[model samples]
Target chain A: MARSTYTLTIPSSTRFLEDARQFVETHAQEAEFADTAVEQFKIAVDEACTNIIEHAYKGNEDHHIDITIIIDTDRFTVRIRDEGESFDPTSYKEPNLMELAKKRRAGGFGVHIMRRLMDRVEYRTRGNVNEVRLTKFRNAEHRRNGDQA
Target chain B: MSNFSVGFRSSNSIKVLDLQGELDAHTASELEAAIQKCQDEQHYHIIVNGRNLQYISSAGLGVFMAYIEEVREQGGDIKIAALQPKVFNVFDLLGFPMLFDIVETEEEALSKFHDAHEEG
Candidate 1:
């Protein structure tokens, strides 16, 4: 008997990470997600938000990103849209750790971690808009008992 | 997706644990359970080799803090080495350098352990 959604718009900066964390934490608590599950959900969402702010905005500090969080009976989904140039996350390949170390790069690990932590991650671009969708199941049964083959 | 992974390897009385992949809230539990299992088995004197670690969130740091406290209570020590710059930045920002003994290489950690042993 749950059908509620919350919306939040904030600057594309790491300073907004607290707001994004609160958004996920609130919905997960409402959905009765286990504390561990809620934690993962928050971490993943924060990474996504950070990615938008850092990569899409390119540290401009002027662009604003819109993030929407929707909570259902068994799942929580966060959708982020930015007015920056279109980009595709699906094309992002997980870099080899050895190579990254050799190059002495500290970035690019954010997207890779997001994909590993979230239940579902999708990216699409349409008409000068870049969108990334993240979804996570709240119920343990839905998560452990769900189809995975 | 575990927050951390620990393995005990003996290189002349120095124990080394290789930590790989992301260490965050989602995966930190696996690390906790694994560490608890090790404690249950009475394995102590730990070194975390983070050569393969890609990212670590605040929750991940919490996991390390909890384990370090437990180890200390039992008269053992925990050390860290090979942290990437970004991951190290997170640790440094959180003031971990003051709380934990962090080294740059596995050999250095072992040498420091030797010094501690001799001093004690």
Candidate 2:
């Protein structure tokens, strides 16, 4: 599979989240993501980065978030790796959406939304380090030809 | 720590939060903390006045989603008012209107809250 990758290390802050999203969106723009997919991808990156800033760094804004963008003709894969601790996002149960809708809870829904938006989501932890990988595939071949699908 | 300002006030039994500037991943936490404070104080009839809010990313939505349960558990609700069309479109696309009672003005939200309180 032909792939290209770029990695960045930055403090676990929202600024980094913007940079990361911009990087992904800019690269993905070549494929022209559908408006909904663009929005979803932006949301997924924001949530993942927020998790790194909140849970991984534990409010310490000094640590770096190691982010990798893997691009291919068929899909874009974003991998977020942090050294803070071995935390598995997959272990976090999908909060009941029925209850979520009834109650309007805010925080726990990020991972759930990310899972919903991405084509593939995997989480693994090793040696006290956590990694979250999200994949989104390009389906609109018409858009690839610069035609809005 | 993202660039934004957040303030809260109470008017006619409605707690209003004024969020200005960008509400993205970076600045959503500040809003979250403020909302939590209101919830912690048992103030559930909340109104988010976003007239000056320029943008709201998914990260921002995550914060509100976090508090959905807290407000409802108290027999209260969170209402959004004066969302810019762009922001509203995002909310609409994400189906926030179904989850929240989004209104066009602070006065409207206040009236609704008053009506709900009276009816209950």
Candidate 3:
């Protein structure tokens, strides 16, 4: 298991979310991860990109999202980068199903979902660029340790 | 071009929507629009058949959440049925089973609607 990295760049629009999903599906499968892990990566990556497109870029198709997949012996990592607005982790609140339903809201689920599916969801801001790294452990023991990510 | 579509039909007075293709941020609006049409027509006893639906994202699930409370308030409910295991897993991950009447088959969902009508 040499560390292998794959990258894809898509415009900041919802339309390309499917493309981002397929990109993860293809590479994750190629990495020979279990079907369940592959599915998890596909969804976590989709949620991350959906957040970047909807909230960070704010529907501005002029922006682009940079996705880098790093396959390591211990983990499968996805690094997403955007030059648009940075996400404020402190402002994020766990969504309550009843509260969202009462408000008739359609969003606020992407971040929660991304964190749910990935073993580690880390966000950082470097200058004007924002990056979020979503990682899933390659081994069962490691995955169990990340059960709460 | 969008790779998703919603087909509308009726089964025993309950509106059924056949969802095909991937449902994500790009395609959630179609489901929302379809559900909206059902709501506007006062057809709240809705069954979403996900047999042919191969993929889904949180945005897709959000559509159901956004409308479920409203429809239920109107004395109607959105029932999801026949989802592929992968899609159902996503719903489960979000605790949707607790909030939604997710069944294994469309007939199962239809019967629930019928059962409710009988009780009412």
On DockQ, the leading prediction is 3
Listing every candidate in turn, what is its Cα RMSD in Å to the true structure after a full C-alpha superposition? 12.9, 5.3, 1.5
Model 3 chain A: lowest-lDDT 10 consecutive positions:
A140-149
lDDT of 3: 0.90
Which pairs in model 1 have colliding backbones?
Answer: B2-B27, B3-B27, B3-B28
- Please write out the lDDT profile of model 1 over residues B1-120, one tens digit for every residue: 133455657666446778777775455666677667667867667778888887677556666666776677777777889898767866665556876888888888888888888998
What's the true lDDT of residue A19 in model 2?
A: 75
Better-scoring candidate (lDDT), 2 or 3: 3
Q: Is the docking of candidate 3 incorrect, acceptable, medium or high quality?
A: high
- Tens digits of per-residue lDDT, candidate 3, B57-98, equal 999999999999989998889999999999999999888998
- TM-scores vs. true structure, each candidate: 0.57, 0.70, 0.96
lDDT of 2 at B59: 69
lDDT minimum window of 10 residues, candidate 2 chain A: A140-149
TM-score: which candidate is best?
3
Q: List, residue by residue over A1-149, the lDDT tens digit for candidate 2.
A: 67888877778766777677677677666556676676667667777888778777886888888888888878888898888866665478866545765565555656766766677777888887789988887764523233344
Query: What is candidate 2's TM-score for chain B alone?
Result: 0.95
Task: Show how many residue pairs clash in every candidate, following the order shown.
Answer: 3, 13, 0
Predicted structure 2, TM vs. truth: 0.70
Query: What TM-score does each model's chain B reach against the true chain B?
Result: 0.86, 0.95, 0.98
